[model samples]
Target: MILSVALLVPWATGAVLVALDGRRRAVGWLAVAVLAATFALLAVLTAQVLAGGSQEVVTGGWPPGVGIVLHADMLGVVFALLSVLVLLAATTHEVLAGIEERVFPGLVLLLAGGLTGLFLTGDVFNFYVFFELAMTASYVLTAYGGGRRQLRAAMVFTAVNLLGSFIFLLSVAGTYRVTGTLAMLDVGERMAVVDPNAALLIATGFFIAFSVKLGLFPFHFWLPTVYAGSSPAVAAILSGAVANIGAYGLLRFGPTMFPAQLRLVGAAIVVLGAVSLIYGAVLAVARGDVAESLAYSAIGQVGYVLVALGVGGPVGLTAAVVYSVVNALNKTLLFLAAGIRGPLVAGAFAVGALSVAGVPPAAGFVGKLEMFRAGIVVGSVPLIVLLTLGSGLSLVYMFQMYQRAFWRAPAPAGPASPLPLRLLTTAVALLVLAAGVWPEPLLAASGRAAEGLLPGAAG
Candidate 1:
């Protein structure tokens, strides 16, 4: 029941809100109320699962062999919680700023529902179902501002992601053909016996699909245009919530279904990460536009996730999870803060900057600390050096953006932000600070999440 409510509540409310006037305060509040309720259910489900164990639900009460499986483990739960929190923050920021579009609130809820379903499902095909649910909404949401620039961004996003979706579906088809099963566990077991060549090809497909989603080096052409083109709320959702799909997909599919292939290309993956780290940071420092620089910085931040994945053990995977969470929180705060101005906004941006720089008392420091551990465990001197360079570059670009965006003498005639927007950003900033000060929960949760990939895995 808890599982069902967690999946259905946002979906049902979003369906109702699609036709309503979300610009009105009452309807906007309704959207927030629905998200809050859904979040509370997820919290309950998280506690339940932690106390007990993973929960599994097969639709139609059919056997696991015959029905779609919805499985919730620590990995799924932690990601779902993080995604919902980001959606809530972005939505609240939009609402408090006076929602302009009728579809803004509803689309966000639908995106939430889709994300929840995608994260929780155990069936790969069902994964595709929920993926589309979210991507379709996001494609539309990218066009939210309804201008030439927003529309063009939507077009690029849609075109590239559609091609990615096609690649993913083709891979799915091949997996079904070879393994004769869509259940992740079954696929994992069968993949060992499947033709090695076929498996490697399919793994490459999955890798490319996720890489495009993440905007990694070489496949990142669409990112800056889309991110800089979209409005702040939409940009936040894309970077903070939707981007998780790619990272989570790689973690789930690679280790569980394509472990051999992952190991085979682990070093290659690290090289790509290193290149992305260098390329993104260098370009970010050169870009003048605040959003564009952050877009490139985002490219760089994800390199750390790839680096940790390449390390390929319990410790490295744990570092990957921790950094992913921290990056999400940092990007969400920074993007939302970009839209608002007045007292306190500069402080909020500074917190985000310091976090990205991996400075103390921000969650990003903990993330980098874990990455350092991962690098040491792997005995990779190059990884350590690359990390140092990345950190220094991040500090340079972050302070550069802060100076230009926030520290420039107060705007002469710009609109002042409402208190709610200021308060929302401040709350997220404090959350980042608190996580750094007391990181036990983040560390433990990420450790447990990595354990899902290999139970009893030791660093």
Candidate 2:
């Protein structure tokens, strides 16, 4: 019941709001109110899942394999919660900055609903359905400002991701053909007995699809232009929220359904992660534009999550989950702050910079610490060395951007960004700081999320 309501609120409201004039104050605030209500519902669902266990509802009350299932467990709810929070913050930021488009508010609501549904779904085909819903909204959102740059970014984003989607759809078809089931749990159970060669090929398809989404290495050429060209609010939403689909897809599909294939390719995963880490950080140092620099930085930041995931254990998975949460917050704050200039905005940017560098008194430190713990647990000397070097590079580039943007740069000749915008960025920065100061809740949630991937853990 809770799961149904959680999905219903944003989706229904979004449909109604699509025809409203989102540029008006009332309509924009109304959209924000609807999102807040949706967030509250998800909060309730999260509490219920945490206190009891996984909560599931099958449409039409049909048997498990027949009816589509909306499921809420620790892993799904946590990611869903984070995704909504990012959407809420980004939407509010745009409202404060003044929405430029008539449909901006409704589009955000639609994206929120899509992301929530994808995170909670149990059917692989339904996951793809919700995933496309989200992507479709994002494709339009990428062109929010209607500038030539924005339109080009949207074109590149749509073209490249469309390719990734086709590959993903084909992979889904292959999975169903091989296992004769689209239910994720049933697929996992059946995948073990199927031919390893077939399973490995399917796993590779999934890997390529998710990798393109995350903009990993060779597949990453379109990312910088899209993130750098979009408006700050949209960039925040894309990196902080939309990018989670790839990370979550990797976590959900890799270890959960294809453990044997994952084990076989673990080292390759780590090597690719290491290359992305170095390449993104080094390129970020050379970029002059703040948004472009941060775009490259995003590529580097996600590498940590991959490294932890490749290590593949309770500790490693926990590290991956924790880092993903931290990275989302960091990117959201930094991207939003990058567009603003005023008193205290630099302070907020500094906090984000420190967080990205994995310095103390910021949530990113907790994520980096978990990565170190994972490295130690795995007893991989090279991994530890790589982690150390990556952190160093992250700090160097972040400092360079901070100094150029906030410290050494001249005051803007135009009026400062609005007070509300600055305040909102500050609030997000404070949240990052609070997470670092009191990390027990985040750690516990991440631990529970990781457990969901373990064998014999409740589905």
Candidate 3:
């Protein structure tokens, strides 16, 4: 019942918003209120899943194998909550600033609906359905400003990601043809008996699709222009919320559906991740624009996730989960802060920068520590050295960008930022600090989420 409500509220609200005049403050705040309600419902659902176990419901009371099953476990619920919080924050930020587009509020609500469904559905085909829902909203959201630059970014984003989406659909077709099922659990169970050659090809297709979404080193050409061209709120949603699809897909599909293939290609994945870290960091140092720099930095951040995944164990998986959560929060804070200039905004940016560099007193340090622990557990000296060098490069670039952006006088020419926006960033920075100082809960949650997917652990 809770699972159904969690998925429906945002979806229904979004539909209503599409017909209404959302440019009015009432409509916009109503949208925010609806999102807040949805977030509350999801929070309750998360607590229920954490306290009891996975909560599942099949549509129309049909059998699990036939009906669409909505599944909420520790892993799915956590990412869902993280994504909603980001949307909530971004929406709040936009509301305080006054929405420009008539469709802005509706689009955001629809995007939330899409993201919620993607995180909860148990079927791969439903995953694709929700993924398209989210991506479609994002495609329009990218052109929010409707400037020539924004239109170009949206076009490129649509073309590149549409290709990735087709590849994903191809993989889905292969999975179904080979396994005779669209349900993820069924696919996982059956993959063990399927021909290795077929399974490997399907896995590679998924890897390519998600890599393009994550802006991984090789498939990342479209990201910089898009990020640089979009408005701040849209950029935050893309980096902080939408990008979760990639990390979540890799985690779910790799461990749950293709564990054997993951094991076989673990080293190659690690090599790719290492290259991403080096390439993203070096390029970030060279870019003059903050958006472009952060674009490359986003690339560097996901490398840690892939590296941890390649290590392939309880420690490695937990590290990947932890890093994903922390990175989402850090990016949300930084992206929002970058658009605002005021007193104490610099401090917020500093917190985000330090977090990215894995410095003390920020959530990112916890992620870095686990990655270090994963490297040690794998006994990979090369990984350890490479990770350290990546951190060094990160610190140099992050601080250099910080000093240039924040330490300089705010242009007397530009309008001052709103108090509400400044407060939002400050609050996010404080949350990042609190999580770092008291990381036991985040650590335990990551471990439990990983265990739910790991071999010999509870599902």
Predicted model with the maximum lDDT: 2
- In order, how many clashes per candidate? 0, 0, 0
Clashes of 3: 0
lDDT of 3 by residue, 1-459 (tens): 878887888888888887887778888888889888989999999889878988889978998877778999888998898898899888887887778788888888899989998999889999999999999999999998789988998999999999999999999999999999988888898999999999999999999999999999899899988988888888889999999999999999999999999999999999998999899999999987788898899999899999998998889999999999999998899888888787777899999999999999899999999999999988989999999999999998898788667776454433234777889889989999998999998898788889888864555
- Against the reference, the lDDT scores of all candidates come to 0.89, 0.91, 0.89
Can you write out model 1's per-residue Cα lDDT over 1-459, one digit (the tens) per residue?
788778888998898898999889888888888888888889888887777778889867898877767898888888999999999988888888778899888998999999999989999999999999999999999998899989999999999999999999999999999999988888888999999999999999999999898888878899999999999989999999999998899888888789888899999999998888889999999999899999999999999998888888899889989998999999999999886786787788899999999999999999999999999998889889999999999999999999888778456444334777888899999999999999998898888888888723321
Kindly list the per-residue Cα lDDT of model 2 for residues 1-459, writing each as its tens digit.
879888878888888888999999888899889888888889999889889989889977898877768988888998889989898899999888888899999999999989999999989999999999999999999999999999999999999999999999999999999999998888899999999999999999999999998888878899999999999999999999999998999999998899989999999998998899889999999998888999999999888888888999899999999999999999999999887787678999999999999999999999999999999998999999999998999999999999888877887653233888888999999999999999999999899989998877889
RMSD of each: 1.8, 1.2, 1.3
Candidate 2 ranges beyond 4 A from true positions: 413-417
After the best TM-score superposition of candidate 2, give how far the Cα of residue 256 lies from its true spot, in angstroms: 0.8
Score every model by TM-score.
0.97, 0.98, 0.97
Better candidate by TM-score, 1 or 2 = 2
Worst 10 residues of 1 by lDDT: 409-418
Predicted candidate 3: what Cα RMSD to the true structure? 1.3
